[model samples]
Target chain A: MTVFRTLAIAGLLLGYAAVTSAQSAVDEIAKYRQQLQDGNPADLWEARGEDVWKQKRGPKGVSLERCDLGLGPGVVTGAYAQLPRYFSDADRVMDLETRLVHCMVTLQGMSLADATKRPFGSGTNRSDFEALAAWITAESRGTKMNVSISHPKEAQAYRLGEKMFYFRGGPHDFACATCHGESGKRIRLQDLPNLTEKAGAQLGYTTWPAYRVSQGELRTFQWRLYDCFRQQRFPELKFTSEASIALTTFLAYNANGAAFNAPAIKR
Target chain B: MTQPRPLLLVLLFVLGGCATPTELDIAKQAHEVMRASFKETGQATLDRLNQDLAQSACSIPPSTSVNKEIAATIEKENMASIRYPADGKLLGDWKSGERIAQSGVGKQFSDDPKNASGGNCYACHQMSKQEISFGTIGPSLLGFGKLRGNSEAIQRYTYGKIWNAQAYSACSNMPRFGHNGILTEAQIKDLTALLLDPASPVNQ
Candidate 1:
């Protein structure tokens, strides 16, 4: 009886120690994120992005300065907060990257291939889209997100996105909800938020276009969805595709009242 | 991409109406959009969008239940497909099973098709007292073998459940591992041992 009691006490202490160590590891990752706030590598991308916005280099020798980001012609302040909206000119809903590509094709007379060749960056082969998204999304910092479902196409996209969130297929029989439908669930040590709920949706949506320290790249919302699809073991989501915009529309619209804050740093 | 199907035109025609549409009506449209939205890359093809009856049935809004008949049909069809090992050995090396459970690789468009897939068990369940990093989507399997004695019936249930989880419970979040060829029979046996073997950390 004495030996059994002693062993039980030891086991309890061991379990308690394991829980605290795991917690401290999570807290440390959070601390790492806070430390990265002051000198965000995303700022470097933003600086280059602003330059790309003003430079005249395409076939038409025009700058993206004239592109209307759904706010008005060349009206960029807080524009990212209202995006994944319907544009009459295109007659389809578009996310910021799709709209940016549209401007490159229409306003600058650049080939679609040239414009989207590097939607994401890799070693020394930087993406113009990343640079541009960084600057444009930065312009929306401190602004409240007010994405609208007023437009019929926007409404359709939002609804379709909602379906995609719950859609299950592929080899693993996984949905986005498989990982994110409930609060406080995680995959290994990484925290997976409940994107189905309001607070999680808002938090997940507003913090994209983040500079990932692991990959050393500023990933956009399109990239986030694209990678998510990849991880979900689905086929590659086409860059700037209607499906991408639709999913983005669902998330961005769900994040209605949260302040738009990104091109932020992340681990 | 091919032209939008006649069904899409029908959907567009309906959306053109004044009445609000049900999610079921829009589900067809969503599937169509997904089919068109993805491009084949690496081993991931457009076929991944193809939904089996169980997948489609389970994808509905959480508030609704798949009608009883359909749920029973899914479970029956899946149960019919379970294949036991030829040698009748359900357990393998639990140490190897632990390694397989730790890995989350394979089948993504970015993952090499040649590489073996991992059960990614640690991503969802607490398997050991030492590994604190586990997801809560599924129940904790710590002390799983300790709770259930290693009878032949218990071993068979563990092996078969890991092989095709959907067979026992239709619309379960657990994958149809053997059915989908995500893990080989050998890997399944290892996973079974990991859950049922007396020496396995999961039982400790």
Candidate 2:
């Protein structure tokens, strides 16, 4: 562990040197990304999350051990790969974060407002959701995405998500398609994945709930949609809302058969 | 891109078997979903969900192109919407224009509504050679004045194009900066100068 820590610090210094060595912007960014992949800080969040899941601390004074994440109760193993699935209890399609929130409310006896108050973490005030998401997604690493769309509501969500992808409005008149619909397009240096197809969907959707280095936070898929809508010059996307679930369903189903690989690190 | 027809056929076949919704039905339902899902926050009101003819037409996939006659009509209508300055002065400080182009903040729910909006031109277009981070979504405007001298016709074309991009190129990815009130006539003049002024860094 000590040796790994030393190597990580040395890699950071080398990355900094590369950044200042008058390299091309793309080369510098690529080098920085390579360095980031060496030792992800997401491991830290996952560790914290495991403790949070087991600790009895909510109003009901119970751990989230009984949370049925579509793989039955208390089964964190490979549960994330099969979401945003229909839950008869919720009577709605829910992605991982939404299900987590549901469990916090139902199993922990926490108020809805209190449970959702800090969905996204700030400095030193980490979100339970982010940490929990980090741990949950990490458990599903290497599992194939198998999001089921057999239910009528699940299929409806998929169709709605498809339409929403192409829906253009607002002052900029931008849609998800504006940035992500086309192949081989980008915004500045960042490549825009065409989420309409399988390959792009696999690359884009299967690797979220990422540890964002720039933001210094474990960003969930809900956070991803929220931030994207902000850049698209649209109104704020509500966390765990139906629209978010639908969009996640579309992307997840498209990424079916790809290996789940998060909580991944991102710049 | 040629995959849309097969995809559509598959969708239709599946829907036919399952009593699934049509494209128009899905579109309407999507709008309803947006209406139910989003709330009015800061500068972004729920009314923003409403799409104009140009927006709806331009929202189609790459496999689908607008009809030529409809495209021409869109151009003509957008051309009619360009409001030139009353003084007929089409130029302003290119330095200010540079700042406006650099700023990508505005119209977001988190942004201050009272703050002046920027054109955010560099988000899509390459304006000056020095700004290596400019996006390639739009055509490069480097050496605009050097390549096309600032003739009266050229100045008018540049100003009009910036005012309402759809006027020049129907269903353009470029926003209608002036027509949408994103930038004022004065700010548009400044952007016009940014492209048309030989003294500007964009030309240099």
Per DockQ, the best of the predicted structures is 1
- Candidate 1 error regions (>4 Å): A1-20, B1-22
TM-score (C-alpha, index-matched) for candidate 2: 0.89
Q: How well does candidate 1 score on lDDT at residue A28?
A: 57
Q: Evaluated on chain B only, what are the TM-scores of all the candidate structures, in order? A: 0.87, 0.87
Docking class of predicted structure 1 = medium
Each prediction's total of clashing residue pairs, residues at least 3 apart in sequence or on different chains, is 0, 0
Docking class of 2: acceptable
Query: What TM-score, over all chains together, does every model reach?
Result: 0.90, 0.89
lDDT at B153 for candidate 2?
A: 89
Off by over 4 Å in 2: A1-23, B1-21
Indicate the residue-level lDDT of B65 in model 2. 69
True lDDT of residue A42, candidate 2: 86
Best by lDDT: 1
Candidate 2 per-residue C-alpha lDDT over B127-150 given as tens digits, one digit per residue, 9 for 90 to 100: 786776666677788898899999
Q: Write the per-residue lDDT of candidate 2 for residues A113-146, one digit (tens) a residue.
A: 9889987998789899898989999999999999
